[model samples]
Target chain A: MAETGTSAARSDAWGVWGGNPPRNRGRQPGELETDQLTIAGEQLPSRLILGTGGATSHAALEAAIRASGTGLVTVALRRLDPGAPSLLDVVERCGVRVLPNTAGCYTATEAVRLAHLAREAFDTAWVKLEVIGDEETLLPDAVELVTAAERLVEDGFTVLPYTTDDPIIAQRLADAGCAAVMPLGAPIGSGLGIRNPHNIALIRQKVTVPVILDAGIGTASDAALAMELGCDGVLLASAVTRAEHPARMAEAMRLAVDAGRLAHAAGRIPRRLYATASSPTGGLPW
Target chain B: MQLVVNAVTADVDDAATIADVVRDLAGIAEPRGVAVALNGAVVPKASWAETRPADGDTIDVLTAVQGG
Candidate 1:
């Protein structure tokens, strides 16, 4: 593992592929390697955070989570349902950390209350704060989100707010002492992919905390694009859960996140309008 | 005493504790992965067996569910 700085925006590129033991994995002589995704001083195994929503069954959800190689998975707190199959059982079996979210809340008080309940229910202080503004878009209410984030942080909770791609809101959340800021690419479950890559990049520049691209992902390419846009990680649910073969899609996303992270580190060639010959002018044969 | 449990009106014994309502009324066989909130404040697991909710008090029993 590479030595990490104490800064909040510490490099997320320290993790090896999938954060798994690289015993027999193929590697070149001098290839760059990384270790784990750290959030709030806790290390996560992978950069992809899977949301346990919209799955057809527990069996399928478990398979998808395993395939994705995600170290953290999001769950929501809801009214107890005795008849409903236990989601905790599957998550515990998978062995990933549960990140409870305030998904349906529209106000700061509601989200704060849910966070408290989640802390007791899950026995963890980590929360994925979400205060929605509009029901149609499921966008974060900027004011309410900041307020809830501040309150949660004050109460010793590690808050990660799901917010807009706007750099200003992202900065505000970070300033509120949140562990991380999750900016959406589009509306929740819309699968539209990153609507504004520029804003995501700007957010990366603005916030010191980790930037996670949450929601509005349709496929593996979208996940890859998020990493390329400088997001530390990606969070999505319907993209994999709603797919015909969730496990397969999960695998694709896992690979894409790895590939994209490496590509981002490797850096891409600058785009040029005019033609640039690969063959040297003097070495070209007549 | 009548207490609102998870939005449903439940008639419970006057001495019913939060744990009682959770186990008997909410039908949670095992309290693992379960949490209770009296009114709007969360009640810790250690206090559930001793804390009794008053009549008309809202008790929200929450647990982990598949969601984002």
Candidate 2:
């Protein structure tokens, strides 16, 4: 953890190779599934959470989400029109759980109001509470973030703050009683990929609740990297929705998330600056 | 001008405020995710109250889209 004030953008320099995720062998020699990622005390089935706001068309958005196979998806209460491609109809048909978001809010008061509104609209307390401090950066206002989290918790809302990967900020958000605290791998909508795996790893290690890596993902590799770093889940949208082939990309994301989780459990080798021999025992064995 | 209001256009006064522009063009009760831009530059969300529009300004006011 390098502490505060990190570079805003994280370019993908990480090395990764992909394969079908390893199967979890239970004690009885049967496969076990890692289901229901619990954040802030709420259990959700899908690791690949989708966003409902950005597709070119309603049908397109619905197709991408269905292809993604997401059990938990996000929708906002404010921007939703009761008419015009209504979310309720799509959400009903998709048959996935909903996690409403509080976007465009700059103050705790407004954020809190939106959470209640989302709860009323979707009948779910889970929310992605984003209280932005800077319009250019879209960074979470840590001060207002905690303030709003505290309020939401009091009202029994599952508050998830979209925050930077600052340990202090993470600590504060978790302490404020957020269901889970989501730290960006990089700036939202930048398509820059994960910038600081170290910071995200640190946040995961420190937080008692699940630490979800949300936003700034460009491809499946980024999602895998987050899982390998021990993040409980991933919240994504553009990586699939914006893809030339969203359905295929959605399936790819699902595999990547599973692969990353299995690899974490499989135990990774320590990283070294220089190449090391994997086997010193190899000496022309006949 | 074949203007686009919420991606659809209307014939309204060129000097309308952003609030007026949206209220007139959108016909929707509330304008959400509507980030106003003049041609390319993003107008601050806070400034929608005081900012006025002019003809040929090429306004691009987009709603808060969630996904890609």
Cα error, candidate 1, residue B51 (Å): 1.0
True contacts kept of each: 0.87, 0.18
Residue range A1-286, candidate 2, lDDT tens digits: 1112323341122111112223343432232254458665556666778877566666767776776767877876533232464555676688987777887889988788666655644557788998889899877888898899999888888787898899788988888888788999988767678999999999998988788899898899999999999998888887777777665577688878877887887899888999887777577767
lDDT of 1 by residue, A1-286 (tens): 1112323332244232224333224645334335467899988888999999999889889888987889899999999888888898999899999999999999999999999889998889999999999899898999999999999999999999999999998888888899999999989999999999999999999998999999999999999999988789999999999988787678789888877787788799998999998877795467
Q: Best by lDDT, which number?
A: 1
My TM-score estimates for the predictions, one after another, are 0.90, 0.71
Each predicted complex: what DockQ?
0.80, 0.10
CAPRI category for model 1: medium
Candidate 2 CAPRI-style tier: incorrect
Error of 2 at A244 (Å): 1.3
Interface RMSD of 1: 1.1
